[model samples]
Target: MPEHAEAGPSRTRPRAPRRKVYPTETFIDGRGDTLAIRTFAEEDTDLAGITRLCDEELSEPYNVYTFRYFLEDWPHLTFFVFPSADDPEPIATIICKLDMHRERTMRGYIGMLSVDKAWRRRSIARKLVELAMSRMELAGANEIVLETEFDNGPSLALYEAMGFVREKRVHRFYSNGKDAFRLIRPLAQHPLLSMAALRERQDAEQRSMAKEGGDNRSAVPPEIAVLLAGPLAPPTAAHADAMAELASLTIEPLPKPRPPPSYIM
Candidate 1:
């Protein structure tokens, strides 16, 4: 009765849930305690804590390969925070990536961010995100994007407060079949300039082609003026006949090739 299912046989048992990462220290929000944020390093290849944190915080589980795909290429984008020098694991962690987008603009992506449950509401997550964003901005990212559960009010509010806008809704995005909302934060890109502002500028530049009433179609862009030239696209007589002949044809089966004689015999 499920709408969608995998092709292979279902497993008899569920996977062992990843280990939970607990904070070793409390992040003093406004108290200004000594914060211990550290970037990821090659020596810290054992990513058990980060994997566990993402599995629990997100709707999906990230295996070792998935973690490596991002971490290996952009280790600087991954960060952690410890409460004290003796803390073994991070109380907070954020992972991100940066690259050029198809639109020829630099883009940054926040893949995962996790903060220990005990350290919630203490500004730990905010600090981690800001740190990552700042680094990515400095690294030439023009915009950033991320996805979160649509119902996660705290996450939505937190990111929105940090200037991320809800861009679109993804239908059934998670493995557990939950919908997600994709958020985007433009670092220095002026979206208004591309949208309404661009439109206004273009409108202001619009000129009458017939102002002097002499062969005037040069006022608009070449493509627009071409479109205004009207619908005179017609096939030649021979081409039209060929097309009609092709359309009247029916599908025919091709003979299957015979196999060569067996060498084993």
Candidate 2:
């Protein structure tokens, strides 16, 4: 493998086998239609539909090893969605895994999330992440993280809106030489949303309260105020948004100061 192509996690197989106890879940789409969300079963091994969705919606390629690595380690975290109970192919899918990331922190990583292009803008990806996060939190995750192509606006916006913060940029992170952003969010250790997000929410709520009636500002939650006071920037890694563009401006140096004119010739 090329340099950094096979990271520590990618080279090592998961310590345990994958397991799932959840049943098919009913999800409501933006169209007010019902959708089925379920885990990948052993017999449901045909992943062509999944690979197609990933290929169409994502910029990178996922081979059989990548798919098996995630599914075999945490089948419950691998989810596929159908338009309905009888739908033949999955319209969306998400793969997730849990592990001790540094310092013994139980971290939950969202490996992949893809939604059919036809199903774009329906908040399907957001719903898929929510489902996975809920399970991860229940499983005792201290934090959650994922990476997205630097230019993937929709994906970045979705994760950021859900309280994930851009930690840093991985240069040449993609096979095509494009960069990527590693986004993260704290789970059990802190609130689900970022402090900035909570502050925004509080501001909105305060405005609404004022609009309804004045003098109830005390209704604001205390923890929210504390979080609002915290540093505005989400710490850990540089924000993903910062990597959107590189500083390309070229500044020319000013001319060197001329010494007192020594008698012009």
Candidate 3:
């Protein structure tokens, strides 16, 4: 994890930095042939190259303008590229949006996940997703979700193998009237899931909070209970103080009624 900037003003605060867990390259063949998987950064002209590749290779029209859009709007979204290890240039790509709804929810919606036909069946898409999820989890997402064409057997199987279950099926969701299946995977659970260890980490957190007299009932209001329980971001001292003040106010009794409305005349 490369430290970029702290979440808070203090340098001592833990920063949610992005790290490339999987190397930018991986062996694709037993004979030492490899492929490079890289997260896209701003000012990368490779987006246009990969977009052109997808267009020419996959006949994908929807993504024709995606690369242009990505270059215009980077950072708000994440893009990953896969290049033949021998070439070390982008040949495939995937894009994901972080906090799409701004609900302070640790979730991401994957879009435009694709690999070139030349690289099909090479497990490059799967590797791209794995790499994306690692960055997403590290950035504080607890769940990652995506939608794919119902007829895309390979994509469906890949997602299922990665523990993504079909959450919904929408009819004619695509521009071409093809149905789409929405799949989701909780990053903090299930075996083989990269972030599964977070469950144990959360348990340890609960135990620590308990030791510090930080019961949920005392600290969180019913309205925001789910948010409080979520792993979005830890509260600041001011937030904690506000909650404590609210809790104290809620526990205080109403002031005694003023002498029954003064007397009637």
Candidate 4:
């Protein structure tokens, strides 16, 4: 049998096409300069500008690696708003990333957003956020989430106007010791509202009630304890129900008991 010819090097597989950037229409700032709003593009070198704007405006400090972590992985989700065609730096920018949250839901997280002071009140921030949300929704994100300073009225109002709700408050979330509000905008039925999440919430509430009961027992005064155990006290089942409600703090018991005297008057 003839010897087989030496095999040639294997051809490399073609890479998948890059995801398309989100589209935008023409927008002019208050100064009549046409603004460009779009995702980070291959030809763009705005990383330094983006970093500068964020550092100048945002309360949080991020190193270059943090910016790279998001931009390199999710360039399509990173958007910028330039005040004019000739301007090399963007006046506003929003950075975001999409991934599985809790291994259950597809969540989009907006990591940073900043707008130059000169560009304030021109609707630039809102427009950039809306653009990011639309792209995230199209990319199969079930919900988009972001955190802003709790007392940042302008940020809160802008997000709320766009249908985002305050999901929860994170205590001392910033390096400056300020609190933040985790806001969420659901493109579809949010995972937090699913049966599994609802069950988890219910169990948490029950545990909280149980803990409250233990606290109340320790806090009860001797005089009030006597009233709860007297002959006219509620029946056993009714008493349990009352205790449960009390533990939940749903209602206050009537006729507040006077404090027990330290000694006989």
- Which has the greatest lDDT? 4
Q: After superposition, how far is residue 183 of candidate 4 from its true place, in Å?
A: 0.7
Per-residue lDDT of candidate 1, residues 1-265 (tens digit): 5669657777688889764333333355644766566777653433876876787766676677667767767888988887664565667789887765654556788888898886678788898888889999887777888898899999999999999999999888776788889999987653433445444544445544355455543544433333333346444554455456646762342232232112100
Model 4's alpha-carbon lDDT is 0.73
Query: What is the Cα root-mean-square deviation between model 1 and the actual structure?
Result: 19.5
TM-score per prediction, in order, is 0.62, 0.62, 0.57, 0.61
lDDT of each: 0.69, 0.73, 0.60, 0.73
Runs in model 4 lying further than 4 Å from the true structure: 1-25, 29-33, 42-44, 189-265
Model 1 TM-score (2 dp): 0.62
Candidate 1 positional error at 80, Å:
0.4
Candidate 1 residues lying further than 4 Å off, grouped into runs, are 1-32, 43-46, 190-265
lDDT of 1: 0.69
Error of 2 at 191 (Å): 12
List all candidate RMSDs to the true structure: 19.5, 20.8, 20.6, 18.0
Clashing pairs in 4: none
